[model samples]
Target chain A: MEKAIRKFWPIFVLPTLGAFAIGFLWPFVWGVYLSFCRFTTVQNVSFVGLQNYANIWIDNTFTHAFFFTAAFTVVSVALINVFAFALALLLTRKLRGTNLFRTVFFMPNLIGGIVLGYIWKTLLDGVLALLDRPLLALDATAGFWGLIILMCWQQIGYMMVIYIAGLQNVPIDLIEAARVDGATDFQTLVRIKIPMVMSNITICLFLTLTNSFKLFDQNLSLTNGLPGKDSQMLALNIYDTFYARSGPQWKGIGQAKAVIFFIVVAAIALIQLRATRSKEVQQ
Target chain B: MKAKKVVSLLTASVLALSMLAGCSAQPAADSADGAAESAPAAQEESVAQESEVAQEEAPAADGAAGQVYYLNFKPEQDEDWQNVAALYTEQTGVPVTVVTAASGQYETQLMSEMAKSEAPTLFQVNGPVGLANWRDYCYDLSGTELYSHLTNESFCLKDGEEVPAIAYVIETYGIIYNKALLEKAGYTADDITSFDTLKAVADDIQARKDELGVKGAFTSAGMDASSDWRFKTHLANLPIYYEYKEDGIGSTEAIKGTYLDNYKQIYDLYITDSTCDPSELATKTANDATAEFVNGEAVFYQNGTWEYANIEALGDENLGMLPIYIGAEGEENQGLCTGSENYWCVNKNASEEDIQATLDFLTWMITSDEGRAAMSQEMGFVTPFDTFTDEFAASNPLLQDADAYIAAGKTPVDWCFSTMPSENWKNMVGSALTAYAAGTGSWDDVVTAFVDNWATEYQLSAAAAG
Candidate 1:
């Protein structure tokens, strides 16, 4: 078996490796290279080192979108994980209709981003309309909170399912042992239940964090970075920079923005995983 | 594990296909800037003359082999075009393809269609930016028969040896209001001769919004940040165009908007007085704005001739299109914003059969009787062709008022904003302008933000493309 595996391993791996290099590795390298160039199409790209990066720092919209996305991710991750964990804990109990409830909670995650955005926009705008107001109004406070509310509503149900798997995997013996030792339910949860779910917390946090940062379709359809482009998120910002403008030259600069975005998101995700993993008990 | 591997491989292959597909742009759609007024007129005599000339040129009785394809920009304008396309196919036995892109998805749609093996032979090349983008692919028409047919030099963009594009139709826009409403409110179309007079009527309507069964003078108060072109690009043109008209030619071609203060005057008017509150406008959807206008809650609508179909469709004969002449002196004669939204350019890479077929179709659309009539009837717009005289929206009272302005020698503003290709400028300016409109941003901040950001973004666009 070992001899046969060794002979076929490379044969099986070569096509995938080739496909990856062509599909991802090439584009990744090209994206980094193009960030320094000034051209419309890839063929016309001329080397202009560091100029694109310089423009990004000075771009007010970039700064705004960055802050907007960071705040959204931080707020969304905390809320989504907490709410999801709570739901998971409740459903994991010997309760009626738990499977049905789990399925319903997970269903929202299946909907397309654009469709969800439009749905939320219509629902929110309709509610606001009843009060003799419209969406994208002069109320700066309203647009900001409206977006946060939208982010939370769309994400909570998705995070709940990830948390359910983690809760289900928690060893029943650990809880029984705590109960035998005269530990209260709250104490058992803190010492045993919560500690065991650390891995799930890490995953849920990462998904929420990354998803929030990379959100484009929802931001586009829900608000379209509208009212004055004040609500423009990072992904939307990169898109507008590339296509919304007249020339193909910004494509390079937009490419640079994308590379930087990847780095930031990757670093944040790594940091979060490391922080969460450290608390996870091996048992 | 096996399924995981399969799915990953499939995902990788699909991603690769998409990347390659994106690189290969569609052929004629990008190049063919379909003239907003490509429809000529229905003339029996002209058709007979055209057919006689065509018969003399080609005695090939079988029109079966000949085919023409046109990439249309507007889906709404397809109603009349269907009849025209069908007529052309029947008369010439040439198949005509009219693929209309949704309202704003023109560029991407154009490129996608162009990359196809069976690319569109005819498409639009509207502005200088459009010319810059698709100039390489354009079929040169310096010596073509179509070159002799063009009467207006102002419409065509020629690169010494080649004519890349021509603005097929020039349109005009302004304040479209109910003429019947105007008469009912103790005013006449003649009374609204200037900006102040028009505003006075609007303000009066606002004062009696409840009494007159109207909610506001202009629907949602005209501050649609999404459709900022109506203000940022078009209405903002009034001051710039006035300055250009005063000199009878543009000063240096490229301007930093010297009369932004005048722009603010009209802009402030749009916000302070409306159906929706200024603060609520940021979240205000477009449908809500137009709905208010159509419901007779707003006496005025700020749009162009393209909206005539929508207006007529609303079944309200009381709602009419008025003049957009804000406050410029001698602006009474100022017509609606008139120019081509897109221009048709034939693809250089297309086959001889395809190219000839496209040219023949274009000529037929411009000169054929049935083709012309169908176009006007559908677009709710008149074609810019010299021989075309059908009033597409003759029943529209608003067009009636806008035409009077045109008759007074107010040459409509040729689309100067098309040069500024940044939705960045519009959106950024829109954000800053909103604060300005709402008395949030100071004049210094507004101008500084506008010019500084404009220059920086302009530089960024140039650097990225350079």
Candidate 2:
């Protein structure tokens, strides 16, 4: 049976491999090549070497977007994980209407990012109007905070589900033993449950980190980098460069920015995964 | 066990075959069937139904004449365009497919569609700057019937002897005022000829707003994406136009912004004597401003003739348009901002037959009785085609007001916003203007964005073009 499966493995692997090459690998490689060329479309390209790369910093908005996105990601990741973990812990315990609460909390994740952004914009703007304060588009600080709140609201539920799964997977015997050994709730959570779920922590951290970094639709639909593009993030910045600015060279510069974006995200994700994987317990 | 093995193997093969079929279906449908069949399948249900009608008619006709796929830019007139196309196809037995891009997404849509194998034979360029990006793809219309039917030489976008694009509509924008509301505020259109009078009247109206039973003199100066163009591009055009007139130039690589002070004054008037708080302008949408005007809550709404449909609830006799006064040198003699941004360009990359079909369709749109009616009546367009006689003139009162201005010999302000560099430049200026209006930033920031960003963006585009 093992021999037959091995012989037919090519049939299983080749289909997926072909799809990956066509759908992702081929386009990715072509995109990287196009980053070095000046063109309106992929078919019409003229090589211009490092000119696109050099022009990336000509506008300071790109740099501003990088710092803004980094700050947003840091704040959102920390808040999302912490709140999601707390919710997961609470829901995991024997509580009334636990399933109901879980469903209610997790429902926000089902809404699309654009829809969520626009809905929150309306809601937040109404609240701001009542307070007689500057609206999200007018105030960069408010825009930033609004986005953070929005990201947390949308992401906490998803992360909570993951954390709940991890908490459940923790052997009941281990938790019981910790309690039997005169451990308090906090002590058991700190020493046993947390260490036991390190793998899930790694996954959650990776997911939240990448998601926050790569956010586009929400940023676009919400403030749209208003208040003089003060609240613009990296993905939105790259998109504006590509679509908002017209010229053959702008497309190449946008592509170059995207390549740089890819590298930064890849490096950060790799480092995070490595650091978390090292801390994960054997069992 | 043997039966279970056979079932598992069969399921695996079926899954792989289905995957391959799914992968191969798209390109095959796209290339072989052409856009008439494929575009509808990919589009919404309404478009799909329209194409099904086209497909039904197509089989009975000869295949000598190529099909027309028009990538329409205006979402507001999409239904009208689709109706016109269907009418043309029913008459001529030619398949005409019209796909309208979502508002604010035309450029991106055009870019992607232009790259497709079954690209749009008929497309549009906003103006000179738009023409620059699409110059290579534009088919020359020098000797074509469409070009011959153009009423004015200036209406054609020329590249030497080649007419690359033709302006289909000539639109006018200014301050659209409700006559009754203006009268209630103790003013008339004649009372506000220049910026000074406009300001005085607006201020008095704001003061007497409660007595007059109106919200404010002007609707809220909305700064959202849907509405910001009114100020950033249209209002901004006044400064650029005045500067160009003073410099005696059509276009420039750098703008001096000599009339920015005037621009500031008009903008100040808009925010101060408005329906809502200036700080809240950032979140106000175009729809909000339109509602205020239509509901008789505001006396003045700054928009264009295209907004006729939206503001038609106000009786035609009650509605009037006044030139946007920005205190220019010949301010009293300044007419409404009049020019064309909607220029039709045939895609040069398309087949010769397709190009001819597109040109024929365009000519038919302007010349034929049903076509002229659709353009003027249904679409509310004041077309530049000679075939559209005075009898076929649009009944839109705002357009008649524009004609009145022209008859009075007021020098119409050409659309200089087209030459105001890139959309990014406009965005930066818009953001600055919004920030300034909201009191979060200074007027100096607006100046820097308008003057400095203009030069930089112009240079960037020039560098790329060179």
TM-score for chain B of all predictions: 0.79, 0.92
Worst 10 residues of 2 chain A by lDDT: A6-15
Q: Which stretches of candidate 1 lie over 4 Å from their true place?
A: A1-60, A95-104, A122-144, A226-229, A270-283, B1-69, B79-83, B86-95, B114-119, B158-161, B222-226, B247-258, B313-320, B349-353, B389-401, B436-452
How much is B105 displaced in model 1, in angstroms?
A: 1.4
Clashes (backbone N, CA, C under 3 Å), per candidate, total 46, 0
Ten contiguous residues with the weakest lDDT in model 2 chain B: B28-37
lDDT tens string, model 1, B157-214? Answer: 7778678776665566777776666676778767876778777877887787777877
Candidate 1 chain B weakest ten by summed lDDT: B35-44
How good is model 2 by TM-score?
A: 0.94
Model 2 Cα lDDT, one tens digit per residue, B222-310: 99988999999999999999999999998988888899999999999999999998998988899999999999989999999999989
Off by over 4 Å in 2: A1-18, B1-49, B463-466
Each model's lDDT: 0.68, 0.88
Model 1 per-residue lDDT at A152? 71
**After best superposition, candidate 2 residue B203: deviation in angstroms?**
1.7
Instruction: Extract clashing residue pairs from model 2.
Output: none
Interface RMSD of each: 7.1, 3.4
